[model samples]
Target chain A: MKQLVRTIVLSDSYAQSSQNSPELEERDPYNRLLARQRGIRLPAELIRDNALTVSGLLNPEIGGRSVKPYQPAGYYQHLNFPRRKYAEDLNENQYRRGLYTHWQRTFLHPSMKAFDAPAREECTMVRESSSTPLQALVLLNDPSFVEAAKALAAESEDILDMFERALTRRPTAAEVAVLEELLASEESRFAADAEAVGQLLGVGMKGVSADQRSQLAAKTSVARGILNLQETITRY
Target chain B: MNPYFLDHLKRRTFLENSFTGIGAVALAGLLGRQESLGAPSGIPEAKSGTGILGEKRHRPVKVKRVIHLCMAGGQSHLESFDYKPKLAELDGKPMPASFTKGQQLAQLQKQAGKLKCMGPQFEFTKSGKSGQEISNVFPHLQKVADEIAIIRSMQTEQINHDPAHTFMNTGSIIPGRPSMGAWVNYGIGSEAEDLPGYVVLTSEGGGQGQPISSRQWSSGWLPSQYQGVQFQSKGDAVHYVANPPGVSRDAQGELVDSVNKMNRLFGKTRHDPEIEGRIAQYEMAFKMQASVPGLMDVSAEKPETLERYGCQPGDGSYAANCLLARRLAERGVRFIQLYHRGWDHHGGIKANFEKTANLVDQGTAALIRDLKDRGMLEDTLIIFGGEFGRTPMAQGSGRDHHINAFSMFLCGGGVNGGVTHGATDELGYAAMEDPVHVHDLHATMLHLLGIDHLRLTYRFQGRDFRLTDVFGHLIKPVLA
Candidate 1:
């Protein structure tokens, strides 16, 4: 069933360009007529996948028990019936797919739920995909994202190369400017509060690779900003 | 980017509501949709201020909203609400063959039929002008005795913790039924724009508190939008409520705007109705970022009021949640379900049950008193009870699960105040007169809320399911 579904969706008719005229835009606002393919924010799983896959860190191992990524402390403390405690994974499991995160019904992992993932208590049919400030917060502050940014920054210092590596496309001029400004501002901010840089670098189970702290911190900031791009979270 | 709305988009919500003037059929049909069947046809992506899109009621109801405090782990009826003077007279006596024979009772002990009858650990006396006999366990609740209608003969099928709670909230011992809160949301819709129609708040006390999951308050077959949102008692108050540490409020706004820019861009490409829906949700969530924090902050409240409710600013106690519930009621949230756990006193009933009673008594009474003081009690229905009640016989030092007869209380809905609805037998073993089943309670609650119990239903697994499950009658005696 899975192979058949994938084969049908992989066909050319399934993937079309959305570059039609404004008239076409108005007439088929929901694209019901199949004029072109529309851009969409990626599903909760792929949002995490795109980050890990771009960096060399994705484990590529499949079919295992769910793993615990970096979540805030006392996140699951409220979960009773013999109160549960979140045990974050420190090994390769931490880099697994978003699907591998521990699925607690009462207390779901904060970042994934922000991306409109249901609590998974029952069969969910049409999952609502919402773009909220919480989602932006997840992209910006969640340790998983921070860790991904640090890993991507370690791959390359050049901004354009980093974008190509993560986004699988060369950076557009406008996108480059957003990244550059974030990098410059974050560098100055972190330089003043070196403790803040230490904090960003201190996110994941694994620590940052040994390098000049200030330079790596700036690069990490740039990578973090790029990862927060609307394009990064969306599928065109 | 434009901070103000584009001329066409400014009144987009107004036009949508005005255009689809079909009333609650539009709202009801929107709140419920099969996932594979897809979102209902012609449902607008976004509406102005996310209140009900005109709920078409069966009739005008006196009770406009509800506040339910679900006492998880059943509260012991014999010790608290139902006072059996005969049981005290016959304390430590073996169960008579007349009551035990031919009756298949729940047994957690090896010698089930030979169990000894236990008397009430606490004293009961008439309280308030109406003279209802409340136990000594709740000193604070005694003051508002006249404001409540106590049901002494409430019955249910489930005797276990999980299933019983399931039955109480969703009207089914089996899982996967839509909760009462969800049904109410689908029926009348929410009034708050920045909050969900059905909001849940859960707290813990010092007994054998059961675990609460999303299932109790889930939307079931209803679309997920109708499901309850459990606001947190600590931290940022809701999931992902706080901005990441370093980002300032302006930066958060910038981030939301930038993200919205792309979402709107994506919407233009697909015209996917979900895109517009997503945009609306993002804006609502953005608005909620400000509103939720404001709602959680109780610093502006008078010190005496906080002291009266026994609520501290940041503590997630039952008192604090009760205070928060009133604030939510004021904001027009359709349903607020607060769950206070640790009521299950299986053994050592005297010592353990008192702790939970004290923990909740003040806050529960204060909620009713506060609502009445604010002139909101007439429109707001408040229910206080557990999933089931405990037996008259002792299990070790505590009581076992008893479903033959239990107790629950109603206040400030359309029910008569200071009234006792039903009666149980002398030994408190069973409801011999005016018995009210779980379904009947559900029916009465729905009737009070302007929904016909049979009329509100969702089809799942080829069977239509309502909160009362086709077996409930309007509890007429309790109604004013």
Candidate 2:
């Protein structure tokens, strides 16, 4: 199964753009006849796994048991029988594959839930692929995503280098300009309020050093936006 | 090919083959196209902040919103609403052979082995100007007794909890069907762009309330977008509603804008509708960041108001959820469902029912009062009931699951208040009057919301599926 997945993903068809001819679209819009490769969103597990892999935080161990990553507080109060309380595995466990994240049958992790993970309470034949405001929320605020951006920012101080490290391509000039503007704005904002910057750095499992906080914050912001780019989450 | 295998109709194949369903067909016809260019992923998106479907009411809407308070483990009609005085007289006696004739009892015959009549575990007294009979276990609900339409003969096909719940929620005894809330949202698009069209909040108290599966809120074959968005009472009202701890709102905003820019660029190149869906979702998430906090912060209400519903801010109590449901309705959520678990009492109905009842009664009553006070009641439909009723026969100290007949109550603008629309026999065992099946209840709710139950259909697998399935009556007397 692993080999099959790798070969399919590494194939030319997998790398083809979802962009296609209107004539083909008019003929087989759903690509039901396999007229062209379709651009589909990454699955819930792949999304997080992609982030962790790109961030260099991924611990690629073969799965054995479920691992708990940091999630929003009080997520499982909806389930009872001895109400559940999530305990974070902040070590290598937190950095494991997204598929390894512990899935409580009643309440899946919030990050997984936001990205359309099935609760697995019943046999799910086809997982529903959906886009919701919740996904944006998760991308912007989830610790895993944020930390991945932080690690990408830490990968290099050069913004262009960071882009290549994260997306594997030099960003277009226009995309670079967008990041530069965001970095300049974030730099001034954080410089003005060091305490606020400190507060931001204090959130999740790891914190960066204080001396380069503002630069790192700005880079982190740019990296976050890059990570959220459609191509980053899209295979093609 | 074997007939069953020949036309098995893999769901995806069928969906892709018949791309022409609603207005997409009209658009395809108008575009000088002889062949279909595929419809936008029919992922049930609310138009802007409105709901996904782009149509108006089929009739004048008497009620524009509905709150389904699900008593998950069937709350017994004998104790809660249905008044059968003779059951008390016949307490501790084996059910008359005549009453059990040709009857199939779940748990009673399957587990307990025999059936014995159980009396009303609580006293029923007349309350309100209409003198509606209510159990002593619910003094607070009694106060609003005049505001409700109680149906005593709601029946279903399933006898077990899971199937019974699936039947009550999705109009099917099988799993993988869009829930009634999903149907309502898909048909009527939401009035609020910031919140989901349909929202589900769950609270369990009785026993481990019948295990609730996500399937209850699944959109089934409907576009996944229409599924119920379960809101949590904590850190973020929804899983990702809040920005991660360190990210500032301004930074997040900039990130979203850039992301959208990239997404739009990709969308233009591919012309995929999923990209547009993602864009809308991001915008909705941005708006939700503001709207949800304000909505979930029920602390904004006065001290007196919180006390009325017995609510605690940030607590996942049924009371807090009931208050939240009203808040959601006020904010343009088209359908809000609260699964208040722990009502199933197969044993110790006398002991466990009261505990579960107390968790919901004050809040349920307060939601109606708050809506009426705000002058929103006329447009808000309130429904309170469970998958089925508890058996009239005693087991240990409780009753088994009874699919034969149970009671449900509807209130708010369209309901004919203080009226009892159906009834059970003197023993509270079987329907003797108007039998209001789950389909009938669904039909009446749709009617109140200005939808013709027959007209609001979603075609799937060469057939149009409805919340009422192949059954449903308008329940005319249910209307005011």
Candidate 3:
């Protein structure tokens, strides 16, 4: 049994493969060969952890009690027994790993649920992976993701640096073109509306300096696009 | 003949020989473009959003949708719909031992031998043309008694709050069965393109509110897509339905477009079907952002209509949820469940029940009337009940949980209105005549929606599991 375990663990089949093969190629039906790379969307916890790690906002303390990150206001409005108003963790615990997020069985963190995390009412043998609009909504608009994008923007030197930090690779020319256009449009919009800049930067626990608001907001939009890219959240 | 040609000839011969059989015809059509055969007679062609069974159903469809008003904490039948005059006569007297012996009781088990009868806390007057006896606590409901059919002999297996809710919602005491809403949505997919098929809304006030677990709405072994999506009564109806603060609608649209473009570029090289699915989901998410705010905004409703429901829009009360249920029904959400969680009264039954009833009474009646006014009630089934009923025996100022007998009412969706069906014993201790189990209720509900309870089976873990779980008898007499 030990020999079988070691052999399987050490096999070439265990190696990561790229998902860059051309479409419509005939391949193994039962997937006996490694075949074209198939990506597993990271689970809810790791999805958040990846964003925090890349943004340099992750509080890497080994272990403690669960944390409460940025969830929408009144997300637990329907919960009762003893009615509660969600008070998010104000300390560095706010940036803790998703594994440490407080688990409310009735109302699990919305982002976690959107990413198909189980409610923990029953033992989960396997977590189901679904590509859903709710997941897209979480990635695009959830405060946690938005704040991470803002933090990633604040820390990075430029758009290319943000791309490297988020995706672990420099953007292709085509990708760079799309992001640059987004950044330019967003910068002018934020430049005209000072309120918008404050709204964007006011999402997380950290506050932005007065002079850097407009620049940070535009870069945040670029950072957000990079974080939401399919490659950033998938493991091949 | 060549061996390959010989095999082809045999297959063609077999197809010609079994041409009368539907399967053979379908197989032959698949083998070649046999357009002349078309679909077999009596089989409906599949349509989008019609779920697993497609356009075909085991029976003719009666209701297009269901609105379940779940009184989450167990309600007292004695005070609500069942008028137990005999039990009232024995108020403060010792409960008959014959009925108490070997019976399961929740919380009142400690006072087993010392139990006393509690009289109905409210008055039940005969109402409407059919003279259905209803409590004064639900005055608005009494006014519409003619539109409802009351069943006073509803029985369940689980006696505790959580398990009873499980039995009521999933027709099983076990934790992991698909809820009835999930089953209905699975059987008949949603008509609302921008909204989920099954939606849950909850509110609590006036009594001890029990905690409701998300498990009650889970789809179990069924695909997660069928699970009930809970819409918050306050703030955004759906979490993340609103765009982030700095992101305007047009800006968000731009972001969605760029993301989809990147995804499509990725899809050109990779053959993952999930990429395509993600693209579709992104489009749907964009649509939801545009549609949900409009759906939740009840300001367009006339003043009198809002007045009838006794709520300001977005108050997160049961009344507000009832109004929202109507909107959801209009948008064609397949199953809408509203759980009012203030009915778990262990003390102050008289005051608390009245308070909770007031919270739901006008809204419940108003929803029925409003739907009727709009000509939608005929095809909309409305259910109003709780997981179980409170006990007949008194525990301090309130009652314990009872599973043997309870009451619920069905309205619209081809129910024989203004009638009472089934009965509890004289003491209101057990279901005595024409008893309806939780499974029976589920069966009747599916029957109304044109599903054969036995036929709507999902195979999981090498066995065929059904909502009724091998036990359900349609309550035929209640059908219109």
Higher-ranked by lDDT: 2 or 3: 3
Tens digits of lDDT, candidate 2, A1-236? 99999998898766656565667665654455545665557889999998888878889999599999887766665564567788899788888998898877747787787666777655655555555667777887788888888887777757888777767887777777777888898888777877767666666577676478877777777888878876778765
Over all chains combined, what TM-score does candidate 2 have?
0.82
Fill in the DockQ of model 3.
0.28
Per-candidate DockQ values are 0.14, 0.36, 0.28
What RMSD does each model have against the real structure?
9.3, 5.8, 9.2
**Where does candidate 3 chain B have its weakest 10-residue lDDT segment?**
B7-16
Candidate 3 residue-wise lDDT, A42-119, digit = tens: 999999999999999999987888889988777677564468877899999999999999988656898998787877
Prediction 2 global C-alpha lDDT: 0.76
True contacts kept of each: 0.12, 0.53, 0.47
Query: Model 3: which residue pairs collide?
Result: none
* Candidate 1 structure quality by residue, lDDT tens digits, A1-236: 99998986997757777454556545643345666665566888889889887766787888889899888777766565578878889899999998888888746788877776776644555454444445655776677887888888888858888888876877556556666666676667667776666766776767776557766777776776667766677666
Please give each candidate's TM-score: 0.71, 0.82, 0.76
Error of 1 at B161 (Å): 1.5
Name the TM-score of chain A in model 3: 0.92
Report, for all candidates in order, the number of backbone clashes.
2, 9, 0
Q: Is candidate 2 or candidate 3 better by DockQ?
A: 2
- Judged by DockQ cut-offs, is candidate 3 incorrect, acceptable, medium or high? acceptable
Error of 1 at A94 (Å): 8.6
